[model samples]
Target: MNEKNTLLPRQLGDTHIRLLRIYKVVIESGGFAASEIELNISRPAISAAISELESLLKMKLCHRGRSGFAITDQGEKVYQSTLQLLGNLENFRSEMNAINTDLVGELNIGITDNLVTNEQQRLTRSLSTLKLRAPEVVINIRMISPNAIEAAVLDGQLHFGVVPELRSLSGLTYSSLYQERSQLYCSEEHPLFDKNNEAISDSTLCEYDAVIPNYPQPIKIKHQQKKLKSTATSTDREGLAFLILTGRFLGFLPVHFAQQWVAQNRLCSIDSHNRYFDTHFFTITRKGARENLILEAYLEELEKTL
Candidate 1:
């Protein structure tokens, strides 16, 4: 029989996981001696751990010699598997801790960029209130793309996510949060900087270079987005705002987020009442996932504030 077939199947115990974790650090640290401070163990212990792990898996995981440390192909695959296993284990632990009435556990929230400046403050207040109610709860927020947020929530990597009300995804539930009003803007150096609604026509505004959001949008927003016919596109609201501030391009930005520049005369809206659109935002959570009391409490707080 080949060497691979000689190994018997076995369940991993705490010792096995510990050895795997040590092996992970060794791989990441690039050498056994390099991992000593991080692992808080001697070089000999780290070496022994890697050897034990290789024995359990019945493979030569790495090579260590005067030529320096190098992970074998099998070791690289095992390291990736170790990362996934540990992540799942932590998620399970956090979820279990959150199921009790005490609301003590971790809450991972993924949010689209630029929501921090929203005037409605629905999410901010909900998070603050959730913390007050559950002092022991650990709250983590990830600022990322709407698509990424939805995907994370679906996979149980994120407990909840806040994103624009674009097309809803399967296996997720959405709750209305607030609407963000966006309007076309030009900076002080633009030709239309001093123009008002009466001075700029729809055709006149379209003649300039423009930037538009690159993410997916609902039909209503898409129609408005098509009007500008942008030469540039950004995946996030912050990037859109940056392009708008350049004075070389006209773009849309959330009214609240643009106020900082508007108040300084650095930006002016172009026929805003006629060129604006409202994007509805929502909080989404995965359906049929294990119950999490911390998420529940936050949702309750959100409902109360909304």
Candidate 2:
């Protein structure tokens, strides 16, 4: 081979990129069989794509058999590099689109779970308005924990997050949306459920098992420490609700979220005086990141809804 040919780098074509994307989907979905519906491609086609990727790279990327699917060490490095390459490409697209006033490209958002039934949240209406204003924008919403939402936003994995205010992080900005009420609750089968409000003492409340938020919320921690037996914890409302409904533990739940159960007499607030604590929800974003027009427009619509 000539010196020039030996020195020449192998250029990745569009086909290679497509194959890498398929490979990525397969990895993300955990196996070829699981990825077929997600990729909208047949299992054989996916296998072919992975095989082609491996051939192009001159290495085995993964192993698949009756045991399970697992990526090789080389495959892990390639996957990380591919993610960075694709992410940078997306950023480039966003930057080029930013030159125009029109809102386009993807808008990734994260939020704590159990917002669907909350009447105070106007995310649906805000999204509808955003769709009307920027039909070209693709909205991706992820239901995550509060701490995860904050971390994802700071890491650039998410454009914005809707979460209850925790201890503030320095590089993020927060704008309050609303306050939610949370109250101590017990299932119908719990010992205290039938007891009159005045009959339950603080010491008695501390005797039973309690389910609490997995994430660190100062007030929740304080209350749980003082008045409940910490038995289990959860990051999402659904998990907390499940634990509470088992009649095995007491837990704190958003009053709005527990309302249906309360009406059905499956759950009851321990305090009849309606004593509760307030958690403030906020729209959180990176402090010094480049402004995104799509995010700005969406926030404007969200503010209007609020």
Q: Which portions of model 2 miss their true places by more than 4 Å?
A: 1-90, 194-199, 219-221, 272-275
Candidate 2, 106-201: lDDT as tens digits: 899998878777788688899999999999999999886676677667746688999886788998999988888787888999987855374466
Q: Supply candidate 1's per-residue lDDT for 234.
A: 89
Residue-level lDDT of model 1, residues 201-295, one tens digit each, is 66876789999887788889878778885899987888888888889899888999999999999999988768889999999998887667777
TM-scores of the candidates in the order shown: 0.72, 0.70
Tell me the spans in candidate 1 whose CA falls farther than 4 Å from its real position. Answer: 1-91, 98-100
lDDT, candidate 1, residue 166? 80
True-structure lDDT of candidate 2: 0.80
